[model samples]
Target chain A: MLSPILEFFSSDPKDKKLKKAVEHIIGQKPSNIMLYRLAFMHSSVSKETVAKGYKESNERLEFLGDSVLGMITAEYLFKKFPFKDEGFLTEIRSRMVSRESLNGVARKIGLDKLVEYDGNRRTVLARTSMYGDALEALIGAIYLDKGFQFTRKFIVKSILTQHFDIDTVVSNNPNFKSLVIEWAQREGKQIRFDISEEGAKHNKEFTATIYVDDDSFAVGQGYSKKKAEQTAAMKACEKLEIS
Target chain B: MLSPILEFFSSDPKDKKLKKAVEHIIGQKPSNIMLYRLAFMHSSVSKETVAKGYKESNERLEFLGDSVLGMITAEYLFKKFPFKDEGFLTEIRSRMVSRESLNGVARKIGLDKLVEYDGNRRTVLARTSMYGDALEALIGAIYLDKGFQFTRKFIVKSILTQHFDIDTVVSNNPNFKSLVIEWAQREGKQIRFDISEEGAKHNKEFTATIYVDDDSFAVGQGYSKKKAEQTAAMKACEKLEIS
Candidate 1:
């Protein structure tokens, strides 16, 4: 029923195909098809408009969607763990919305197929983060086409429940060092961690500085070497905008 | 009429005053008066519950409100400047929600009087940022009490429009160096900038590192000394979570 209605909205075969794909992914028909169309338009393929420095791309939508996603995740975690402190909630939210997590979600939902980008561009442009970014843009499109309530329901019901196992994510302890190493290996980048200690033996503090491809990325400090390394890895992941 | 109704809802004089104040500030009566009371709870005056680690305070609400405010600001900027790129929108939004800006808004709306905190504690705790934080917590409470649409309208109509002048914010050029210096003075922290230049004189690049209170805060790079310092100041501002 939804497919036929979507098909009736657009006679163009390409538009019909896009509408069907969107409906299939989001479990509903988009009110404004153009917003979803714009959401899928990566900057690589986006053409500059009449105004100089302005181009029709998903970047703006991605910006908006990022905030929307953050709010929803924050609220969900706030209610889910009633007794948890802000630090714990913040940590969990970051893990959930991490680049690796979003990329996995995007792939699982078959969003990679809908993303339109320049095929001839550098191979690195087709990296995993692109899928995650497109997922965010798609969320922005949903938010605009429908209001916040509908978008929140869609994200909570269709996206979070469908793609993410909340219990598993909450229970599993994240090892940032391992996560960063895995990312480095996949991206074929050289990653190194340097540690230094200071203060007395009884109260020594370790500082870890992370370097990617020989350029310093970020640094973190902890009481133990492992803790310091983990902190550094976490910071590096944030700085690299990976995981 | 509203005051008499609020008095009728609460027999306690303190509760009546609080309700009247909240109503006056937000332009509406709150459905859950307890939420508003929780929003004003400062950690300095907060008592831990029987749950041990869990405390009744506004920190959790602050965390939630921060995201709600972020999304509302992002959407507001997204719609207001359709032609502006994401970067521009981000900068302006940050400026609007900056510690200094929010503090000013909180004071303008007389939120400082409503914030509950330990009066005998360190004078720093009663500084400008507390009002800003309380403002955010109030926003979070409003979100939880009235839902997103009502909160959005309140933020736009009562808060944003009444407090912020959008045109002045957009037109003014931000000087990060000055901003950071002012913050350092206010916080009574020792601030220093170290710079290094490399490459040919014709195409030299400058790197600036900012240290606050004798600790390295952040670093930035640019084509000139002033630009490098400005960039460093901007990064330091973000690291310190100040304007």
Candidate 2:
């Protein structure tokens, strides 16, 4: 532990910055800063390794971290809802580990700030998934640096249980269509969702409009009818102030 | 350990049958027959536990086993391909854990004979997935009954390495369209896939026809254009003996 502090003064500016970032993200001092460094190394700037292989990027780490996340989440669900059916377990698990949820977690942990990448304009535009991918790679690094038991505790106590609100996640249906329909049914109000397709045969767009009691509530467009309905329902939910 | 053998001889006929099946599947003596029994019990015949909850079917076990499978597969891939990129790892992992692969593994393990489910005509149609689910549940039961190490050995040695042909799997592309296109390009043959939509708007269908050298080679159908193309490509591969 003292080594890190001692090295802090002697370490280069970049190393010091990385150490700080690692400390902030994990809430624990990093024992293997190299692994953490690799975790933040994006594939965009991937170099060659000694073995003529590409310099390791967060992708491999992301793969392992994804499994670790799934296992930990499954264990949590098994214990938390002992009597719940598999459907409930699967639904809750999906909510907890969804891309949107992970993106939020990544933002909260400031992973976007830590990532190192070199990219072109098109690549940069496609890197909306970078933060979440970095977060998973961080987890894989932690698992390797800290071991499985420590990683499990770190994730359960610090990440999932600490950062995410369980109640809100459970109650908040990402399937906005289902939520709005339930709300409409409870109030005995008529609700209709109309979806239409437009554009050329190869590149088509779907538009969905929601009507509540004969009043146009919201309109949304997407590449698919389901996505369009979801978008429209989300807008309707925002307008009506219903979860 | 001897208790299982004694119980097999003196127990009810059903318990005897279950024990026999369990032994056949795991290639070991049954230390706890109850867990194995639950592993094979489908939700269709679900009863009530003392807690008034639906007597746990293989669902929870399957959930746990799915994670176990993923983790084990990740570890295997990590060790097997030290320098391989994440994309390679992900593709192989998906291939190994795919439903078709799992179902094939389940069938090889004779899960078709062991699972006990009470179902009507419609439910029976869905039993195609039951065999694979039971196989996963059985894995979960082993993890609990024996330990992680033993479960790992069971999966890696008894199931994956022993039964699966790694070389064939690696060479075979699940993307039939890609495989067929590559073959067509090498052979200097012109090929085209034409897809059309059919059926009701909501319950839509897509059909695809593959033409090689301006002659119809194969026809296939699916719910989506991409799937239909894939189906047609698969048929073309079969007919042309191309992949």
Candidate 3:
């Protein structure tokens, strides 16, 4: 049933390599070669195709895959932790799908070898987690090629089960923002965070200052606002002895 | 096959009303009546069941449904606007799934009549978008009960094409943030926004101040930081005359 489609991709050596890599990673022969090709085509390598104000790269696929990943993960956690509340489920899901986690998983699954991008370390794309983004795009490709049910099974059986241990993820979730909020709610204290972005667009940094009961306690900085806020919250938690 | 399930729900008058209402809105009989019932159970009314420090309400389903809605909408927009970039697709999707839009759609579908909640205007839930939240939860219920394809068809056919006009939605999208960012990118200018939250949690408002080249250009306020930023961006656009 699949020999004809397999032969189409195997005709060329380069296509054979992609087909083999994708098949090895996703555990299935890709029906659509174009989608799999596009999934790995990072924006850094496609800067010229900006006629529509956006590069013809994997970004759109990333957006779609991100949502698919979220839904699948949410449902997984929702069912797996039936008695657990939304907060706990959300934390675990976030841990499982964090950029760091995705990048790690993508590298472990050899996606970094398939991802096409500018290799220069100074490039903004190189600095960011393009591998993770590629992984998401690949998932999007799988979804579009094989439909939602197949994608869900692949994600659950292949990605989640193979790559992540729920117990470990739950214990390792570094969500200080959620922690601080929970603490504030318990202590009946007012908590807020003020985030400011600075530096150039390529090297933008976010500084988050956390306040409790209108008093600034700690400040932290990171590449993103969420990370900065988490750092700030972690510091606040430490200061308030909220372990 | 469905008669047995229909008979199961039709036994109770209230359940029958709910069954009829949900069937009317979704254009299908719900197999899982419990999921549909849980979809309309607002947090305000479920505060008593806080064993896990979170109320047993539609929130978890809402979270699940939000991702499902996002993925469906993203795919829909991606396929619909083949020539448009991710930014345009994102803006349109945001417009389509905005709190105001969801609330309007839910009311139009008569979900307001079925949704169970405290009707007191003074309650925070009443002031906020519980209707929109319920709509999302309902989508979650549909996805869980009938699966993704059915939910996607229902959304596209019953909700998107029925309640929303694509052309009008595209033309009327209030995305001043995108406009200002585009202008800044074109003119090689620096533009940034600082958002601050004020007042109590229940009545909190976000004030977004737009800055161009380190100088504050304009400020706007709204219930959400995104809205406030959009308002500020609109004012900045008016002053800069980019449009």
| Top candidate by DockQ | 1
For all predicted structures, in order, the TM-scores are: 0.74, 0.65, 0.71
Better of 1 and 2 by DockQ: 1
Candidate 1 stretches greater than 4 Å from native:
A1-10, A174-243, B1-10, B175-243
Pairs of residues at least 3 apart in sequence or in different chains that clash in candidate 2: none
> Can you write out model 2's per-residue Cα lDDT over A1-243, one digit (the tens) per residue?
335456545567888789888887677889878788888887665555655534567878989898888888887887787787665576688778877778888888788788887645336435467778888889889988887777888889877898778888778666779889999999799999998886556445578999989877789765568767877887777556565
Error of 1 at A38 (Å): 0.6
| Per-residue C-alpha lDDT of model 3 across residues A80-176, encoded as one tens digit per residue | 8766655467657877898888999988988888988766533655557899999999999999999998999989988899999878877775667
DockQ of each: 0.49, 0.31, 0.28
Docking class of 3: acceptable
- How far is A187's C-alpha from truth in model 2 (Å)? 28
Per-candidate Cα lDDT values, in order, are: 0.82, 0.77, 0.79
Write the residue-wise lDDT of candidate 1 on B121-218 in tens digits.
54857564888898999999999988999889988887777788999999986788988999989879999999998655454657899888887777
The most accurate candidate by TM-score is 1
Sequence-dependent TM-score of model 1: 0.74
TM-score of 2: 0.65
Model 2 chain A: ten consecutive residues of lowest lDDT: A119-128
